[model samples]
Target: MAKILVVDDDSATRLLLKRDLKLEGHEVELAKDGEEGLESAIAFKPALIICDWVMPNLDGVEVCRRIKSDADLFATFFILLTSKVDLDDRVQGLDAGADDFLSKPVDPAELLARVRAGLRLYQSQLQLSESNRQLSKTLRDLQKTQAQLIQSEKMSSLGQMVAGIAHEINNPVTFIDGNLSHGAKYLDELINFLHHYQKYYPHPVPEMQELAEEIELEYLMKDFPKLLHSMKRGAERIREIVLSLRNFSRLDEAQMKAVDIHEGIDNTVSILQHRLGGIELMKEYREFPRVECYPAEMNQVFLHILNNAIDAVRQIHEDTGQIAIRTFPRHDGWVEIRISDNGVGIPRGLVSKVFNPFFTTKPVGAGKGLGLTISYQIVVEKHGGKLECVSQLGEGTELAIAIPIRQHRPPHSPSDSTPDR
Candidate 1:
């Protein structure tokens, strides 16, 4: 049952409304004048209020205006009672926030019907408010789940990359270790023979001379230095490869730091070098400032975009694909990097869905389709940057990324908690 309040200057009128409304199974309260009605509306928090339009201190119109002005009381339905039956009087009552009007000598049947209608409206408002609260809670929960999934995917990708790099490093290390051992042994044997020849063969010995000729002593001496130099060069190459892997992974870095954008791009290119067969890479870099960002995450962004470009080129069966990378500083304290490829371009219809999670055009087992989605989040959400794509079917595609040189705050703010999807 709804709670209602009745206000009138006439004692008889107030009594009639209170009695009839109570008989209808409603809890009713009475006020002698408009001022009392306004007070009781707040104190009792009634679902509906009925007041006379003409009264001594505060009138029904004034009371309705005050009630509607208060946010807490605005939902309470108001009905105005008046002796005047003119259209202007009705309009004035409505303009002051009266939801309904009752003529003088109010009919009991009509009063009950209007009260029931007002009750229905109040109930619906309450239901709508509750639904909104529940929806907000569901949105928060979904965001939390999304964050967990993204992090899990990132760790899985890192594990696979680390395994591949480990395998690549092992081959070069094994070659360098085996070759160094054999080279040391050969050098030791040659040193001992030369020492013996100089100490014991001060005079000419026919046997020693025949042995030297058979072994090709002059050629061996000249080629030994070259072999040692080759081994040294091989070891150096292995070092460079390991360094590139380290730079690309950035595993030791857990927070934002100033990092060279060009270095990160070069490192990513080196890591993906094996898959770049027949793909010509051209770079045009300008002097740019180091940006404050999560290096590992940024490197992952580059790898994702580049990998997609390479795959697009391969799919078209291009004999010699071209991937061009360009970087320059913007006038607004931001750096822009653009990676373009001449390959099978993305269809216009699918361009919008490229950043959507788990959306892929590749065949089953060939892709997870999280690459571009994760990249978009890293650039736009985490770094407060912009990532855009331009593509033309049958021509090529280009992706541009822009990030500020310095971050004023931490990477993840409250708003950033929500995933792009």
Candidate 2:
């Protein structure tokens, strides 16, 4: 509906005009005079303006002139209605940016028709403006999706390469551990043989004793087992690292099943524990309800959000900071997961744009700024729930994900809601 602002000095005129516009199903606001009109115009930002031409202290002509002069306000249509009908008066009103003029002793029919005409023009402008806005938003979302697709492909390739590299390293590391284990056994046997020899002979000949001393047999026999144990330990560490890398690159199979939210959080934390080594963690997990979800995708969501909170804490706090994670059931029958960190919080202005993909304050290579954005899509768009955050600069940030205990369809299936479509 069009919002029409009526500006005139006469109280009777303002009331009648406002009442008439309202009866026609338009939202009507009034201003006492040109001065009040100017203030109302900026504040209300009406779609159309119906202004009287003559008034004291800021006349309608001056109001029109100022509105026309301001580039930002020039798009507003101004209709001037006044008693002035001389050629010079008409010229002056037109020059002052009145889109149309209506001479006074107004006919109610003609007034409504002219107002209708202005409303139509205003509506046309609104439709065109809305179309432009939608188009621009669509373009931005398309670009972000394209970038995500490319990144996903790159990650897939990297995962494959990582698995192969881990496999290669695992082979040699396994052999090294096996060889050290076997060598340690052989040394044990050799030591027993020497003991038996000593027991059987009771006494060694002078030359044999000298030869054993020269070889440093005693020292080698004592330290060799410990040295072998150390080597085995080192090999075992390599084996564990190789295993972790393999797990990290495991393919994500799309499967919808009941998943434990707590378990997913545990796995996510375990995977990122190394990254969190420098930060202190405080967890308050309430008993949670399992929900139907794609386990792998859900895991990814946790990873993205948790990683972001960790990064934020690291950035803001020079000293070790705290990360608090909590989970509980909400009254809405949704499970609420909150991940909070005391670190450099988001600026007030940027809080609104955090989920705009690729919008990041991190250094160029530090981040791609898609973590929170992807998480938001997963919780809200994918699972039919909400993702929200409370943050203050220099204080900290809290990211909350509330997903239904049972899956929710958003008037349709979540999988069916494709961004491109």
Candidate 3:
């Protein structure tokens, strides 16, 4: 049975309504006036409240307004008991938030019917509230799933491209690197033999002297070794670049492994070396244990953050920029990477939104705006860590990444991969 509260200044009226409502199968409570009615309504938390228009302290219209205003009590159906039947009086009652009005000299049949109607409306409201809550949860889940799918597709495409490029470049680099030393040795031997012949026979035949003078033989002998050394150095540099590319890709070692985070950071820096022309790159790495992580993905995170720092400095048209990177192990089994830049800092208002997908300060087409968003996911969601940014307007920005030395979970699936960009 529904719990109902009946309020009236007249004891006789209160008793009458109580008797009638009880006979109609509702559990009824009594109140001598509007003040008492409000207190009882709060304490009893009734499904419906019947309040008289005239009362000692608070009136029925005021009581109904209070009930409708309260978040907790707003759902309770309110019926105002009034003697005035004038059109304005009815309108005033409705304006005060009354759900329904019962004409004084209450009709028992009419009152019961109205009570039933109010209860039905309340039930509908409850159902709609529940449905809306469920819909919101479903939408959140769908969005998360969609983001994972997109990330998977991106990583898969990137992995394929990087692996192919690294493979093609590695073979030629290895060949040149192996043959360069032999070529340098051969040149050195030839130069040494020519020097010995010159030393043994100080004077040559007139034709030979003329030939040596014409060809600048002395200069050739002096410069040839240096030329070979330069070529070998160039080949070695190319080989180092190829190695960096392979490290950055790390496709074969996609599974969780003990990885040097410093190596990953260095590889990323090497790949972005061209962009660091006027930037002073500083590294303050303290000795730390190899972290268990997906090296390639972590490298990507470093790339994204470093690229952004470079872009920020460039945006201000700075002739020279500064990017400082520091790494150290936290006592609590976590490793911290702090990357900061002396560039145009993120605005205070936009700092919090930096990691939100598609939110960028750059002009349209300049950026896809997914770089930091994807970085946050890789550091936090995939690794169970934290990624945060601190910035001041017109100053600079610092991004801090902290992850456990060893992940607590198993390797992530393709759907959990970081974004390709």
Candidate 4:
């Protein structure tokens, strides 16, 4: 049985069609005029509408046009009933999206047959809609899967490279760092002993003076401490870099653990030091508890966002770029990390699309536009948090990521509520 609507100004015609369709074991609704019919069609969503050719105010054609234009009613079969059988009239009805036509003084058998045929067409339309919906869902899932696979491969490669580099650099840096203090101390002692010898025996042999001059002893004595101090600083810088690399990779801490959020942010910044030569970074960090999260994955989130910030600021050839990072704990137990960049800001209309997969304003070969999309997934889906963006034209953009301070037992599920936006 199917739902059907009958619209007509004539009382006899309405009664006849209603009795016939109801006797056919179908749910039928009757409307007195075109306006009433259009209302019923929308609210009831009938499978078929049998409308009169002409009526007061709005006509059958106009009602049919409106119904066909509606997305939800696009597949509702329409049948026009009229007394005039002129070819021109038929064309006009068809032009208004009428599916089938019925002549006045309708026969019960013909009405039933047409209704059955229209119902079959409606069912076919529904099936097609369902198929299209399923296909769309499958496409979205496939896109999401592809993005994850690519990220996973990159993560694996990066982890291996970072681990190897840190290890190799740490070994040599440790050697230099360990010997730097002793070397500095030894140089100081030798210089002191040389000064004492010079004081005790002011007059020395011609051979000793000639050797001292050849070695530039006066300048060496003055510069030795400075050179040794510089070497120590360099070794320490290398050690710091290596430490940052290891912390950013977090390969050893694969599982969820309590981690310093500031440490993760600093580690990411340290790794990006080469790119920040001309940019000023400002950090406004608030006191917050160590967040329980997948440290490495969270670092990846920071990496993607910071890289985007770098790319944004790098575009402005005239101005020195600035990226500001602010972190604070919310009263609702979620910590928010906001990264704002004063570069070429995103257009107001496109700010929403920044997180869409494969949607990029970047020129070809520059980027794949999956950075924010993947970041959104990690912060929202993996951590059960909210990723929000606020931007204006030429006014820069700020991406705020909010996640819980403590991860729930399920890790992915949320015990506390995250921000809706």
TM-score of each: 0.57, 0.66, 0.71, 0.87
> Model 3: residues >4 Å from true position, as ranges?
1-141, 409-421
lDDT of 4 by residue, 159-240 (tens): 8899899999999899989998999999989999999999998888999999999999999999989999999999989999
Give one digit per residue, the lDDT tens place, for model 1 in 1-421.
9899998999999999988999999999999998888889889999999989999988999999999998888988898988888999888988998999888889999998888888898888778877998998887556545743875577657845874785688687878867787887878788778869878876657997888789998678778867887877788767666777877776666467888899999989988988998899999999987788888889989998999999888878555789999999999999999999998898899988887767776768878777877888889988999999999887989999999997777476643343321
Comparing 1 and 4 on lDDT, the stronger one: 4
Evaluate residue 197 in candidate 3 and report its C-alpha lDDT on the 0 to 100 scale. Answer: 91
Could you tell me the lDDT of residue 307 within candidate 3? 92
Candidate that beats the other on TM-score, 1 or 3, i.e. the better one? 3
Q: What is the lDDT of candidate 1?
A: 0.84
- Of 1 and 3, the candidate ahead on lDDT is 3
Q: Supply candidate 3's per-residue lDDT for 351.
A: 93
TM-score result, candidate 3: 0.71
Best by TM-score: 4
Q: Candidate 2's residue-wise lDDT over 225-330, tens digit each?
A: 8888888889987787776566555554354556677867776676677898779988898986677666656666778778887888888665489999999988
Which prediction has more favorable lDDT, 2 or 4? 4
For each candidate, what is the lDDT? 0.84, 0.80, 0.86, 0.89
Q: Is candidate 1 or candidate 4 better by TM-score?
A: 4
TM-score of 2: 0.66
Clashing pairs in 2: 316-344
Ranking by TM-score: 4, 3, 2, 1
Which digits, one per residue and each the tens of the lDDT, describe model 3 over residues 315-420? 7856688999999999999999999998889889999999876678776787867778778888998788999999997788999999999777536655335442
